[model samples]
Target: MVEFTDIGDVPSAEVDRMRAVYQPLADSVRELVDATIRTEMDADTVAAVRAEIDAATARLRSRQIDGAFGVRYTTGGDSLAWGNPVIGVRNPIAPPLTIERDLEDARGRVFTDFHLGAAYEGPPGHVHGGVAALILDHVLGEVAAHADTPRFTGTITLRYLRTTRLGRLHAEAAITRTDGIKAYAVGHLADEDGVTVEAEGVFIQPRWARG
Candidate 1:
């Protein structure tokens, strides 16, 4: 598993409490996004629903943060990347990928499984190529973070082997090698049938982010 020694100073109990309070709201928002994309309601009904949504938005806007919710952590060494665009718990536009990492090993391997709905449609019934890249990019980054070595993507190249359908998908990434400050990693995305995308990336430990 990756380490967050330099991040997430909050308490684990507090983090869990916050998630318990907010995850349901986030889930509802995700559902709203899916419904909005697939709704077959009439124009008038849509307008009315839009009005209600606006009202709710206004209510939430009454109290707001001034900036993005960056990565946060707990005293117990847990970090929550909740505002992440691809996996954030508080983000509705995310595929909301749930990642699992190998804590007992240092290979920097990570895996995730998620379902893409109508909100992620492209190429008719298929997922957008860019979306696949997004998922792989994030996973590859994590794969490079194995053994708590924090890094950022320097470059990533992806090849689409086949069209990914709009349903259950799986992805995995692992570090292939490392050279000084550079970590090379490879990953792939697959559906039930087989591989759909392959990616390799060079992750760099930025000077500024290093202790």
Candidate 2:
């Protein structure tokens, strides 16, 4: 990863306010995605809905940002990774995760709670295996960051233990070992029944951070 300076911070209240506005927008878009994929509407109805969607899309694009939204933080120590594609609150494809650190109890462990809706469907009733890997990679990478040993994901290997159902899911990761700048981590994703996927990864702390 290229070295970049921090973007500084915004007030927590401002961050919360922005989240309140955009989070609901993301939810609405997610609903649109789910409906688009699973709708049983007839041809005419589908056409009508597409027309409305196109209109809405045009309105939103009327004024647009030039590029992607990146992570930001506040001087008060509040950080928002809300623009992340996998877990970002403003992204419809995201699982919209709320991750927590278990720094005191498990040290390097991190856990995330999220839901997978119909938009993530694969194999009729289960989430796409690739989506599972995306979630794992983010959480496993965050595990290193939470431990104050941040790194970019070098490689990730996932074992789909079983089909992950379309519903509430939990994931957890912790650093298992380290060799030089490489941090090895392992984790799993589970639903109400049990774990459906397992993952292991090596994350590399940049040479800049090591110094």
Which 10-residue span in candidate 2 carries the lowest summed lDDT?
Answer: 1-10
What is the C-alpha lDDT profile of model 2 across 44-77, one tens digit per residue?
A: 9999988998999999999976676766556677
- Regions of model 2 farther than 4 Å from truth: 1-9, 147-149
Clashing pairs in 2: 9-73, 9-74, 10-74
Residue 104 C-alpha lDDT in model 1: 67
lDDT of 1 by residue, 142-211 (tens): 8887445678889999999989999999999988889988999999999989999999999998786677
What is the C-alpha local distance difference test score of each model?
0.86, 0.83
